[model samples]
Target: MPGALPYWRLSGFYFCYFALLGATAPFLALYFDYLEFSPARIGELIAITMLMRCVAPNVWGWLGDYTGRRLAIVRFGAVCTLISFAGIFISKSYAWLALVMALHAFFWHAVLPQFEVITLAHLREQAAKYSQIRLWGSIGFIVAVVGLGQLFEHLSLAAYPLAIVLIMAAICISSFWVPDAQPRHRPEFAGQGRFIEQLKRPQILGFYLSVSLMQLSNGPYYTFLSVHLEALGYARGAIGGFWALGVLAEIVLFMFMAQLLARFSLRRVLLASFLITAVRWVLLGNLADHVVVLIIAQLMHAATFGSFHAASIHFVQRSFGDRQQGQGQALYAALAGVGGALGALYSGYSWSTLGSSWTFTLASVAVLAGAAVIATCLKEERP
Candidate 1:
């Protein structure tokens, strides 16, 4: 594995991948609000995109595994995502937007899961260093959120599609630069059992289920935090600042994640992340007006996303061998899709009716439920 890390190549993919996220995730709701869609309708639109995630990743992941063309899948998905997303420029009607979201998201969501498989395979035995590479994504996210925040502040969100188009183009270009994760001739040496059999283990199922629950808890934060903050009267740049703050915390944690994983048990890391997530949601739900309270809650991103994601990636890497790599990452993405769609769908339906306080309280409850599952079922790895 000497000189192994195609650091910039892999990091560029992550950078552009999350840069697109930075453009869309924190701001899409604002764009919807700009279009005057009701909260429920906004949720529906976001949900359509998320629902695509549940299906597309597994379909593409399976294809990649069967064909051993992980990078090819990434490129095709990227190219088509950009093409499908072009539909956004043609109409703002509910039906039109819904169709565009679904079509583009189908291909967009397909890219990351397979890319994850490529990334880990590239890491070879040095998987612990994943956080370092992944941190570039956080940096890209921070830059996009803050920069785009300022841009949209001065200009209309009408500029958003163009910004995203450019970012998508960068994603397409980055895909061309990376090689296939593993050579077709090299047979997998992951473990003794077939990948499907690994699913029968309680630990494996429990971990996957826990991740979905955690992602479900993130629904409000991802879907409505912008609108919620805006309704509270924060400016767009300030709102972006809050989003950046969380990822900033994430960046710091990612820098040290290798050492943290070395010292802490995965179960311990996950349990702490989940419990703290419960607290963070409660604070965000109740304390948005207070900048200090908001900062504290944002700081929790280290646990909520950084530590939890690192642990989850390692778990999947450990679970699936070389042969099932694509599907393994795909399953993780698919389950997360299930959780995220429900989160966005439910939060959208409830936000105006139930209100932000209650919406996030429900989120808190979901995370605690995940913590309960992990405590009972996550197993220690055998020596």
Candidate 2:
């Protein structure tokens, strides 16, 4: 399989990973809703998962980097994820659910940044092919979300956790088949700077702040957009369709992102993503009642998420060089993880008390603040 097309092989793994998320992301809250978990309990559960994202990846990345054993770490993590997720099958109470989400997320989040290290190692010569590789994740997400959406329309929501377990098993199996690739060491920066100094550079700082804000704004959408849509009378299938549409737009953007990055500065691409995100959120908050407007807002996800993420990864590669790749990716995961966790926790409170519109409006405000910080403080020096 290593001789297979790179995109198909790499993306097949991601398809499994995110297919698991697609099953969980769209309907986990809804399942909890069925179980009559209080809004606060639901928020805590999701927030804890994101919180684990904040803590686990750093420790795991450091281990991978220190030992130079990234693939081994990834495989170990997959095994742990498979075992930990089974915890959910036996327990349904809020406290038990929190423990399960925390454990699974610790291992699940541990794998991606390291996988990213491996992906970049393989694609160093033809980085433009990232979208071709990554688009399968969108495809996987669509399959799981759409398939399970219809399933839930007819079957019991109790089956949702099992759906995630099955998909994760596929992820672990695919992961085992993924070829092990190690990043080439950069001799030029072999001993150049401290991790703190690399982090303080203008362009890197700006990109991190910008994306942290972007993911922060996504808090409300990831946490409650489905609930909000359901409240507005959007059927489950239509809601999944809307979610899938955002990723489809993401697929289109990924198709051409390599060219876009080659032609434009990462700073420019990053800035455009931030502006569009601000627009997307505000539109979602105020115009969600209008289907056409909402669809337009969703389409902007191509730029808001796809372009932003591609550019952010590029900036990290440029900013940190080979030596700090682990740290760079970990920092991205950390800041975004903490921000996303806060966003989910806060939005849960906001969603329950203040309402969805106000909650999303606040998220847009966070984006605006992030954009301002990037504009004022982030300076890009040509390499």
Candidate 3:
């Protein structure tokens, strides 16, 4: 049965795609710094990517659901992403960089949510295998963060654009390896508006709000922790290792995700993630140069991203059926974009105007609010 699944193909796509994230996420802000951009400007640039996600995924998801050509959409998104990102190498001005970021991200963000529809369609019966395939993404991230960190130490970061381009190429090649999903049609679908109904549920609304805030809270970590640590005098390799440690913990958690899900309620897992995320922001903000504190906070990624994301994925899968899957995932991604874009914008402004300690303390408070919302509003969840 495992052999029958398109395991390697699915895994390879994740590997290549996340490797692209690895190429950019930890280093891009630093690259902005290298170009002498201000904190607010950098945040705006980062926000451009998330801002595109707010629109692109929905447009693509609707196309996939109506046409049943999710893989074709994935391939098209990937190719366009490559074409748009190539502009990065040609431009260095603030306006040029911002334009490219928006263009490529619109296409890049469109791919993953629909691909989620495809992967879940393939794993229709054995969805738990998702963590197994997804772990390779963590592995890819770890490899890129760690290897690129070392490489940048020896060479100027001028090499960064080329690395991203190559990863984009790999993602394009991997797209051809998987087949499209054939969703089982239902007669009740004629009534329409099923997704809108699902969104109206109080608990569902709370879940999306909480998750959006969680990502909003993460804007600093994803967009600025490397720059923050570097400002405090950490070596590039050390910073990369710090990022890798978090994902390594995430990988270990993925390996046992099924067992964790079996024993714990989804609310419990999500609550823990929210609580721990609050703690991580606090530590990162207060003790940047403290290696021991940093390590402890890094370990918390298992809960912040790992457990929280796994639990959210299961919730989405449980909530939406085959016919509605694409839109459902696209909605999930879209909300995250809304939150991330806002977070990045505010965090960027706050980082320069308010200082690191206050900025992250604010992030911690936001996570606390999310936890409280979950505790009170998310009562229906048992899994």
Candidate 4:
């Protein structure tokens, strides 16, 4: 490890950032349902937030790359995100909530991709150790999901926005403690041409497409799993427990990710993650009524999110030059947002019309398609 690594500060930022996600992902849809929103309306509300990801990251990435002020951008975005999200407390109407979701998500989406660039810049030569720091995010997620689940069980779902706002405040405070680091430009990849040309390459395009599909498959899980579990007679606390179980599995994967990356090629890791994710969706859709089966499915999150995400980050770092790092990470986030929006929309419609089992079946099909793309288009490359 580098002597100068701001390890705790970097990890602290991830912890707080994802802790917000922990609060949001499991309960946001549930909160909407609590307010008597229809499944489609809930999906639309979530999609609005996701749709911002399609635009915000690119706009912020360009500014960060151009100004070489990635950390400053992260700080600004963090503050804006907190301010914008606080608008949720203003109204419960669909239109009003939709506006708030879009407003907050634009800035919220901007923070992570630029922060990713900052974290990687800080890591420098110890890039494979990225998972070591990122695992704190999983821990944060676990804490938020489990703790909030228990809390919400006792209190009202009305408190959801307030809990998230407090976590966002922590995110805002943490961003300031981390100092900035610029990416070291590598000339060897300069011949690959500009960012546009690099993106046009077959492998890069395939990798991104797979990323979108993976997120798309995750749509049903993120947008409605709590609702689905609730309808199946699980309590709010158990729903949170299930969500925490998935992140617990993710945290375990992160702990070993450096060793896994050293031993396995990124393509292999991704392919395996996709394949296992397909199975996971199948299990989630079909056997969620069975506690043991559900446990197995949740554990598969280690592959579905943890391994897939770590590999994707490493891929962007290797494929783009320092000059393009911000854009590269932004594009990754943008594509993910694209996939997530589609996932949320489709799952919302399908959940009510097709039923939970069929909706998850569709998610599995999406993951299978992503796996096929990986197998056919991506070549083996060690991280």
Best by lDDT: 4
Residue range 285-325, candidate 2, lDDT tens digits: 77888999989988998987788877777767666667568
lDDT of 4 at 288: 96
lDDT of 1 by residue, 1-383 (tens): 35867988999889989999988889999899999999999999998988999999989988988998888889999999999998889999999999999999999988998898888888887889999999999999999999999998899988888888889999999999987777222345545576678888898899889989998999999999999899899999999999999999999999999999898888888999999999999999999889999999999999999999988888887767677878888989999999999999999988978899999999999999999999999986531
* Candidate with better lDDT, 1 vs 2: 1
As a TM-score, model 4 comes out at: 0.99
What is the TM-score (0 to 1) of candidate 2? 0.95
Lowest lDDT sum, 10 consecutive residues, model 3, at 183-192
**On a 0 to 100 scale, what is the lDDT of residue 339 in model 1?**
95
Deviation (Å) of 197 in candidate 1: 2.8
Against the reference, the lDDT scores of all candidates come to 0.90, 0.81, 0.89, 0.94
List candidate 4 stretches off by more than 4 Å.
none
Worst 10 residues of 1 by lDDT: 183-192
Which residue pairs collide in model 4, if any? none
Expressed as tens digits, the lDDT of each residue in 1-383 for candidate 3 is 47668888899999999888887889999888888899999999999999998899888888887788899999999999999999998889999999999999999998999998888888877877688888999999999999999999998888888888999999999999887776555555546566788789888899899988998898888888999999999999999999999999999999899888888888898999999999999999999789999999999999998999888888887766677788888988988898889889999999989988888998999899999989988874444
The candidate maximizing TM-score is 4
Better of 2 and 3 by TM-score: 3
Candidate 3: the clashing residue pairs are: none
What's the C-alpha lDDT at position 303 in model 3? 93
Query: In angstroms, how far off is 240's CA in candidate 2?
Result: 0.7
